[model samples]
Target: MEIRLITADDADRIMPVRAYAFDATPLTPQRAEELVRYMSFRLQNTTLAAEEDGEVLASVSGIPMRQNLRGVVHPMLGVAGVVSNPLARRRGHVRTLMHDLMRRGREQGRPLSVLYPFRSGFYARLGYLGLTAAKTVTLRPEALASLLTVDLPGEVRLRRIAEGWEDVLALQDRFLGSRHGFTEFPEYRRHQPRDDDEHWLVTAHRDGRVVGALPYRITEYGGELAGGVLLHDGAIARALLLRFLAGHADQVQTITLSVPPAERPEQWSTDFAGTIASTVAIPHPAPPMVRVLDLPALTGLPAGEARVTITVVDDALLGGDWTLDGAGGALTVTPGASASEVRLTSAALSGLVYGALGPEEIVARGLGAVPAEAWDGISTLFPRADPWVYLDF
Candidate 1:
């Protein structure tokens, strides 16, 4: 089997295989043709595939994106379009294509690749571990009565989504300041509402300056008004909840919101029982798995000074001895260091770096073991900051 990168001309072959892999809504012939033309124009040369007998067996695509690692931004490949021909399953094609993609990322000094997984274990075996959580909560508007009575800081007003786009951008800039694990979706593709749905954008302003913006589409569920609010901060989240409760008290029964793992609904609501009458937390447990493409690049994330050695025991793509030195919030990760060795697999190392697990936990789970002093050093080298993506690609 031969693995190769796909150019614009190869979309005709790859898209069908991708549709099968994803089990996406079946596309009409005209829609498929339109997609082929559009994908070739948009995607260009960011796809990889494994071929046997001139037939593409498995494929994946990579988009240029970045991730916030402890208040620092690092380039990453937004991995997607992973698919294999059903007839060609279990031929190691997906694994081969992924290895090639990761190798390319490492060569470019792009240290990370993230993807929402179909199966967590499959990617876990390929040196990736869960790194983000999709926190979903459902509650009636009455549950938010607590926040409605309390005085909010900013002036809340309604506007069209396009009108509030700039305020949203400004708010995100302030919100993600010095924050770990967040990325901005550019204006060109901000996941705007589809054609049929109507949208309402609410902005919070203080001193005539936009501080926060909430944009969402209203949808009907079970013959009642319902909509899921996408948000990142606690203040804005509470304000939006209050707006929903106050404005649509009788019309809207339930308002759903997707937030980062740390922002619990109970924290803001008055009554926990009234708040979470349904599932307390609909946990989307790191649908995306993360892989460290470049050990030195990832190890170089900003932190206080510490020099530690890591020995990766499995998966040659990330296996080797790495000396990570951080001092004065600067990092220098170089090969050939003699020190207390922290031995672990590539998967375990990714898990540790991306906040999936810590050094002691990995050792306890039999994935890695470290000495007492080395454990302390590792903490200083790789500080714990939960990673989150604004949206899964």
Candidate 2:
């Protein structure tokens, strides 16, 4: 099988593969025409496919994105749209396509790649480490009633996304700037078509500035209210947004929102010890996985002064002995360093850098072997934090 980028003419071959893998509607001639027209405007140059005898077997798309890594923004590739034909199952077509995509991303100067996987173990084999999954919090609207009782400074307004697009982007920029593992939405996705009648953009304004925003959709005829892309400046903004959501109690039965791992919604209430009445928050089992493509490019990550040598084992992409030297709050990676004190896989290294896995946890999981003397340095250089991605690819 030959791995190559899919073109507009190959839509017919790929659509069936995608339809079968995703259980999407059967592809008809009209659907093929629609895909061709869509691809013409939103080109699929970044989408790779495996083909043999002029038939597409498997495909994956890599979307270029920028993600904040410990306060430093770096180029990242968002992997999505992975599919394979049923006839091609058990073959290595998907693996080949993924490897090609990773190589292309590295060539394009992307240091990291992230994807929400169908199976976490499948991507884990490809040197990707799972980060903490976002929590889906479901609660009765009355659970947030306490937030509405306060006379918050900010006022929440409901508007269409188009009317508040600029303010929304600005708030997201500010949010991404301060957070770790948050990725900015790609320009193409920002301009994608949306059903304005079904979706609403809720924003919180303080001093005539957009302090927070959340895009939501009400489903099941007031049975559920689902919100995502929730960004806020501070406690007041968050409270205001929660209050706005509480106002929907009469119309919506439950308010469901996707929150980052670090967010604790129950704390919003004055009584923090008790549960929010009947709130159920579930962390997604399969979180987005991350892989480091260019190790040297991450030298600029903020860290305390420490010097540690490590070896990455069984990694085709970043396998070798290296020294990580952090001095004056900046890290520098020196390749081919000897006297390694820690041994780990590329997935462990990615987790450590992303602040999802600490040295002790890595050792506990058997992902890495660290000497007693190296624990402090490793922990200092790669401090633990809950890495979260607000946007889903």
Candidate 3:
């Protein structure tokens, strides 16, 4: 089978493979046409397919986006829509496509590739390590009663997403400035809600500037109100958003907010702990995974003061001995001298660099080997922090 970039003409053939892999419903002629249109729209991204003798077997798409890595923004390739024909199973077509995508991403100067996997283990073999998933805090709207009583300076307004799209994007860019692993959605995706009237953009404005915004959807009356991309500038903006959500107490029984793993909703209100019904720390069954595509481009990453040399094993893309020197709060990687101190796989290295796994945890999980003397340097260089991706795609 030959792997090549998928064009508009191949959309119909690949649609059936994707439908069989992801959707169980029968693909009637109308449904197939609709899916073809959708696939055609998504072709703006870099999509690839494996074909042999005029038949498409498997396909994948990579979206060029940006992600924050420890306060530094870097280009990232978002992988999605991986699917294979039933007859082509276990033929390694998907693996070939993924390798080509990673190569293209690295050539384009993107340092990272992230994806929400259908099966975590399947991508784990390709050097992708799991990052912390977003936390879903489920609680009754009454839990935010205290926020309503606060005399905040901002006024919260509910508007359609199109009316406040620019403000929302600006607010989100500010929010992502300090967040690690948070990725911004592509421009095409940002405008998706313009056509959907059901979506609501709740904004908190102070001094005629947008301080906070929460885009949410409430499908049915007395059901759950689901929040999306919750962004706040400060304490008052957060309080205002919570107060607005509390106003929905009479209409919705429960409010579910998707927050980063580091955020503590229980501390938002004194009665939050008592009123919270359930908290799914990792709401998605398969958390998002990441892989470091261009390691050299990650120079000057903020890190603790330390110097360590390590070897990356079993990584076809980036494998060898390298020295990581993090002194004066900046990391610099160079060729290792002589024998290395630690040895780990590329997945382990990705986890360490992303702050998802500490050096000790890496050792405990058998992902790496660390000598007693190298603990301080390794630990200091790769401190543990919960890396969260706010955007699903």
Candidate 4:
């Protein structure tokens, strides 16, 4: 089928594809249109497709974001409505569409891409690894004690984000600066109006400066979950979290949170003590993937003066690690060689991506090998920060 970029005018055709794909899904026509409207705003990179005969079949689109700190720009492409005609289901339309979208992302210089996959394993094969997780739990506020009692970290204030867009962007930056795996908010999206959910942005200040912030709000369903952006510092993060949970106490019965893999609030939340918990890997990574996309990128990324050559086997693809010339500013990953230092597959790589296990632990578990002393250095390279998504779309 002929695949091509779509424009606002094609919504009629695109909407039907979405409806056909999500017919059994919980999404309604309005929800589908709302999503289409969101995607339409990013006309440049957005894409939609139809069969060779001109029948719409799939679509994907998203805006780009910039982290002023890193001076890097990447678009967060959201893949949606990737449905084929029922008779064309077995055809590789989905795979072909995904490849086209990924190529488009790379062509536009977006090193990182994300999407809430219809099937986890399906995306894994496409090199999209599970990075972070979110825990959705149901608990009566009265059944759980008030999560916060002590004074907040600073001149803590809660206000509606809709009142001012500048305040929302400032708070979002503060949160993303200290966390990894969290996508940066794009300038356009910052001012882009939304109506699906009401957001209350809370901030804590010390000495008249904002130290932490969280964007959240309670719903009529008698449930409240940590939403939108979140700043660094677990204590301040927890404070904002507790305040949100506390406000819903007695009236709310479930408290869900989309958190960084390393920031496990359930472990520290007095409200959740003794409560059984479940978690799903979030769309973002707990510790964002750090591939040596360019050798120069890694050289300047603070690998430290100490260095060693360790072999890593990627079961997902090629195996064997190359000589890492820290002093020479080079990395040569190769395959098939005599015995070397460490060995691990892509599955084990996931463990390292998250803080689930350290280098030493991985080696002990027969996943990989590393000098005992180098473990600290290796861990330092991958900070254990919570991964958060700036936008669900």
Candidate 5:
């Protein structure tokens, strides 16, 4: 079996496979052609793929993401899509495709490849580890009545995010910037953001200044018990819950919000009857895959720091643990740390960066260990930003 790059002409073969694999709405001929065209324009060839006999078996794409190191922004590839045809399932085609993609990404000077996986376990064998933990909670209206009854001095407004809403966008960026596990979605692509039929984007403005805001979209089934909300936090994540619930009180009896595993909303709201479900697995307990194409460049990320050494254990093929030294005038990562500052697998490192696992807990769980003094520094190096990838592509 041979895997190669996917060209625009190969859409006929690839689309059928994708439609079958996803088992969703069929990809029309025109749509497939358009998708390929868009992919060609947006992604570099290094991020393309196909399988045996020129058959488009599996595919993935990534963009060069830059990080500020010292004063420079180093590039990394944020990969998405790991689609494989059901007919080709269990054939290891996806693995081969990803491995090659990682090599190509690295060759192009991208030090790392990041992706949000459908199944954390499924990707580990390919060297991708769980970095983020998604939380899903079902909200009961009766339980939320008290929190909802509190009259807010501000007026609540609901509307689709539109052009010139710089205040809302700016407020969102400011709120999510300091947060861990979050990524900024550039303004250019907001034309058709997904809202799952019942998306609620409510903003609370007080005294003519944007203060509280929430971005929520829901999925409905036959009734309220089945349908729930997929909520992400903005400035007014907690505040908008009551009003949002009232809007859907009859339609969806329960509203669920996916949040950071560490954030405890129960403390803020009195109604805490619902159970918290983890969207992805914890401690990963799966094979972790990741590739750092350029070490010096990868270490020069813009989480902002004067100079520091961060130890990483990345076993995503061309993987190893080393002291990423950015501790001088120039940002540099060298492989000469005898003390093994922090020891964990590549998967563990991804999980750590994604805020999936706490350093202290990792040590307790036997996944890896870090000295007490080093914990604080490690946290600072890989701060949390709400690990939200704006586009699912």
Candidate 6:
């Protein structure tokens, strides 16, 4: 079998494998056309295919993206549309594809790769970390009344989505600036909400400028209302949340929406001990798996008087030792280890890089031990922050 970059004509061969392996829907002409067009845009020079003799058996495609790590944006690879023919299972096609993808990403200056894993353990064994974590909050409409006071400087209003799409995009960009692990898509048009859904586009405005956007979905059974809201901005999260619940109060009984992991019921309302409730961690929400392809690229460390030399053990990915020195928000990386070295695997390193887990948490998990001499400086090197994946692809 030969593994190599693919051309546009390769889509014809790839679409069928994808349809059969994933969606399982027959690849009709129309569906193939739609997919091929999208693949042309997202893939272009970035697709890889595995073929034996004259038949294509597997494929993997990636796009360059910048994901926020702590507050610094680092170039990364976003993997998607990986598929293999049913008969080709256990042939190591996917493994070969991943290794090539990692090497390519490293060469192109992308330090990380992320994906919504079909089997977390498979990737975990391949050196990917399960670090992305988020929470969903369930509360009554009445519970949001207290937070209405945080309403934006202006007012909230409904607008035609096609007309307000630009405004919505702007607000979302503003919100992403402070969020970790948020993937900035190539364009907002790719994520444009379809009109077929029972959803609404609304936003908060101040002095005729858009401050935030709220896109909500409503689900119902037997003519009663169930609530759905997506809040992206914490500053205006509560304010827009209040507006959503208040407007649908009479129509909806309970509302369930996502919030930061640290945002508890008590933080949502004064009566968390009363009517408010949650469905958090009973079955933890799965986050996108992360693999560190290039450590120095991802660890563009912040300006600080702290520094550390570390050895990252990535058996299937980029694994080696390096020295990381930083001052304030600036960082410098050397090819080898320093005397006071810290040891970590790809999984542990990903958590530290994304700020999803603190050094103490890793030590507590028995992943590895941290020397007392390097604890404080290394702790400063990897500050904790909530990193959530907002985009699937």
Q: For residues 1-393, write the lDDT of model 1, one tens digit per residue.
A: 887778888788788887665545588888788778766854543688888888988888777676776777777777878788889998788888887887887776778778877777778778887754656667666666766667666667776676666676776666555556666543333444422236667766766777555566556543233444455355664565455545665666666656666666676666643333222221223456788887776655676577777778777677777777787777787885653367887777887677667778778877777877787777776777677666666
lDDT of 4 by residue, 1-393 (tens): 788777777665666566666555556778777766754565544565756677765555544553211222334444444566666675777777777776665556554456666566666555454444444344455433554565555556777766644555565666565444445545555555333336776666666656666666677676555454455455755565556556666676665444443455555555464333434444322223221111222233322333444555643232355443334332222333464555554434444433345677667766566767767655654334344444554
Query: Model-by-model lDDT, in order?
Result: 0.68, 0.80, 0.83, 0.52, 0.54, 0.66
Candidate whose TM-score is highest: 3
Worst 10 residues of 6 by lDDT: 274-283
lDDT of 2 by residue, 1-393 (tens): 888787667666666676666545766778767765665444444788898898888899888888989899998989977888888877988888898899899898999999888877778788899887666677778888777779988688888777767777787788678888888757766555242334688999999899988888888767988887568878899888988988887898887777777778778766423222222232224678899998998887898788889999887778899988889889899895474769988889999888888888889988889887888998998888777777776
The most accurate candidate by lDDT is 3
**Clash pairs for candidate 4:** 132-282, 133-282, 175-231, 260-386, 260-387
Q: Which candidate, 2 or 3, would have the higher TM-score against the true structure? A: 3
TM of each candidate vs. truth: 0.87, 0.91, 0.93, 0.69, 0.69, 0.84
Give per-residue lDDT, candidate 6, residue 116. 68
Better by lDDT, candidate 2 or 1 = 2
Q: In model 3, which runs have C-alpha deviations exceeding 4 angstroms?
A: 273-284
What is the lDDT ranking, best to worst? 3, 2, 1, 6, 5, 4
lDDT score, candidate 3: 0.83
Error in Å for residue 165 of model 2 = 2.0
Compared with the true structure, the alpha-carbon lDDT of candidate 2 equals: 0.80
**lDDT tens digits, residue span 1-393, model 3:** 888888777778788888887766688888888899888877777889899997888898888888999889999999988888889889899999999999898988899999988777778888899876566678888988878778878698888888877878787687577778878867766566665655788999999999988888996899989877677877788889989898898999888777666677888876774332222233235678999997889999999999889998888887888998889899898878765769978888999899888778778878778777887788799788777787876
Better of 2 and 6 by lDDT: 2
Alpha carbon lDDT of residue 65, candidate 3? 83
